[model samples]
Target: MKRIFKFIENNFFVIVILFVAITLLYPNIFSWVLGKVHGINIMNLLLSIILFGMGTTLKFENFTEVFKKPKEIGVGLIAQYMIMPLLALTLAYIFKLDTALTAGLILVGTVPGGTASDVITFLAKGDLALSVSLTAISTVISPLLTPLITVLLIGNHIHFNPIEMFISIVQIVLIPIILGLLVNYKFPDFTENLKDYLPAVSSIVICLIIGGVLGANINSIYTASWIILVVIILQYFIGVALGFVVGYLSGMKMKQITTVAIELGFQNSGLSTSLAKTHFPNYPIATVPGALYSVWQNLAGSILAYLFRKYLNKEE
Candidate 1:
């Protein structure tokens, strides 16, 4: 058991890769698991558990980093909002994707930096604190900003009740995250010990979630395969380029640049998927980009983190 835990801890990225591979090979297993777990909103439960663990990791000080370095945070935020929506619009125009997919791609771009970015930033020897602050602020602001951005960019493409989206965000995104934050604040050591365990749990559940979504819509892959791959590739390069350019232009260090890159590249596609299901049920394909995104972003992020670490070491 100890060895298993340690193996998961040491090779979390490899585990994610393996999970993706398994899901691709045995896509039906996701449906099997979901069917067996009747009466459970497996996706929500997984997200709640993930957020609960995240809360334990939070510190009040992490939130304060924004106030101290407003400029850095501001630049990061600008890059996030700009790169995502613009890329989505451009890609949608170039490919002439359906409204649902266009909206999904836009939402993926608009959602802020997630907790996973913080882990990758740390792994890449980047600005861990800055990444944490950006992630916290982004998550906190997402309930408002994400919906507003979605409406502004894709409102014409779909019938979006902004009020409904707001409610969904509160139920799915805000409440769970806040509860997790409070849990961590009240019990520091307990949260710390559980940190190593939570990622593995979240990871396995995320894999399941991805597999379930893919299996359900395996048919979409036939027509949208090229489109999905294009969005994934474009989103990644744009994210990395935006991060590097913005960080350099803002006079940040190499480590800070890497942090920004990862933060921009890795999003909370899970959160976006939940939001789409709850509020944009009419546009089911809107969740596809995010679902496939969960798989692609992790693959790219792991490679980028490895490269950044090696490059940083060489420079040092």
Candidate 2:
């Protein structure tokens, strides 16, 4: 048993892939949890735990890194905020996706960077500090920016409470992240030593979130498979391209370029899902694109990270 757990710890990505596959295959498990789980708000609780774990991984350096390399972070932030939303809108129109799904896609695009970006950045030999800063700033700014952008871009298609959405952001994202940072500051050694385990726990939580959502809406994805794939790919590519374009235009280095690209390509789908459920309950389907993107982006980012690592080894 100990060996099996250690193996899972060593190959976290493979575990994530297997979890997602199993969840996708047996979505009913998600429903069972939702049905059996009481007022504990299991999903939200798990998400909060994951967010807290994320905070433990952060430090003041993450934020200060922005000042050291403002151009790279700025370009990456612009690409992340711009590319995905535009692509979401365009894809919605082209695919003529269901109104609820269109709004969901837009929400997914509008969301800020996720904790996963930092992991991906590290694995790809990109700029960890820049990714952390970008994720932090984008997230802190989300309450104001995300709601406004969502209202302007997608509110027409779905009803939402910007205020409620903002509140949810505070509860689920900002507050937990702040708490995690405080915990890290208060107990630096523990956080540092426990870093390895955090990844595995985070991976498990992420897979659970995806699984729960997929299980809850398995039929929707099955029915809209092509549209979902198209939107996910479009969001990823546009994000990657825009990140590189902006980084190069700003004269960032190769590593910075890669960091920006990965950061821009992936987003905090968990936040999007929470907002969709809280603010737009009438249109639960609006969370589908974000949920699907969560699964797809991790897979694509893992492949990209592996390829980049191999290429860098050859260059050395």
Candidate 1: residue 28 lDDT (0-100): 76
lDDT of 1: 0.77
**Which 10-residue window of candidate 1 scores lowest in summed lDDT?**
32-41
Report the lDDT tens digits of candidate 1 across residue range 158-214: 887888777766666678778878877787777887776787777776776777777
**Where does model 1 exceed 4 Å of error?**
17-26, 32-40, 312-316
Q: With candidate 2 superimposed using the best TM-score fit, by how many Å does residue 204's alpha carbon deviate from the native?
A: 0.8
Q: Candidate 2 — what's its lDDT? A: 0.77
State candidate 2's TM-score: 0.91
Model 2 is weakest, by summed lDDT over 10 consecutive residues, at: 31-40
What are the lDDT scores of the predictions, listed in order?
Answer: 0.77, 0.77
Give residue 46's error in model 2 in angstroms.
Answer: 1.4
